[model samples]
Target: MANIKSAKKRIKVTLVRTERNKAIRSKVKTAIKKVESAVAASDKQLAQANLKNAVVEITKAASKGVYHKNNASRKVARLSKAVDSINA
Candidate 1:
């Protein structure tokens, strides 16, 4: 328990931010999974569509500070590669 008024407020803020971040992370994970599943199924069109959505989600997450820019870029690169493999 926080004794000081500011400490209590800080605790509350931390809890709120944690929940928000968790939701955002879950969304990003879902987007990634969708792309992966499409790739695994060898559905080129579906994979391409899902890859676009995944990239958008990843970029948004990075912009929101939930993910580092390099990390997001890596994810996007990997997904793009997978989609490209399907094309080839």
Candidate 2:
């Protein structure tokens, strides 16, 4: 219920940004899950590939401001550790 033009515009912009960020976050989560699942399956090739994909996705999310740099790094680190622990 923004009556002012500026306030209305701001609300619209915020909504658009939120939706875009949500999509990016969802994609990042899905990529991470795929990597984890591959690791759990103990498929070295798939795990390695998926890990690479997850890392890329996470880095991109960080760059895009969806996640803090350190937070994204931590997530990537954990995901990699999981994949590394899997026996091929």
Candidate 3:
């Protein structure tokens, strides 16, 4: 239990932020998984579509500071490679 009012408020704010972050991360993970599954199944069209969605989600995450820009770019590159392999 927080004894001070400020401490209590901080705890509440932290909880809210945690919940939001979790939701964003979950969405990102699901999007990534959808793309990965399509890649694994060798479905080029579906993988490309899912890859776009994944890139959008990842970029949003990066903009939100959940991930570094370099990390986001790396992930996007990997996904692009997967899509290319499908095309090849």
The per-candidate count of clashes, in order, stands at 0, 0, 0
Per-residue alpha-carbon lDDT of model 1 for 1-88, expressed as tens digits? Answer: 8899999999999999999999999999999999999999999999999999999999999999999999999999999999999959
| Candidates sorted by TM-score, best first | 1, 2, 3
lDDT of each: 0.94, 0.91, 0.92
Top candidate (TM-score): 1
In candidate 3, what are the lDDT values of residues 2-50, reduced to their tens digit?
A: 9999999999999998998898889889998999999999999899899
Candidate 3 clash pair list: none
lDDT computed for candidate 2: 0.91
Q: What TM-score goes with each of the models?
A: 0.97, 0.95, 0.92
Q: For model 3, where is the 10-residue window of minimal lDDT?
A: 79-88
Top lDDT hit = 1
Clash pairs (backbone) in predicted model 1: none
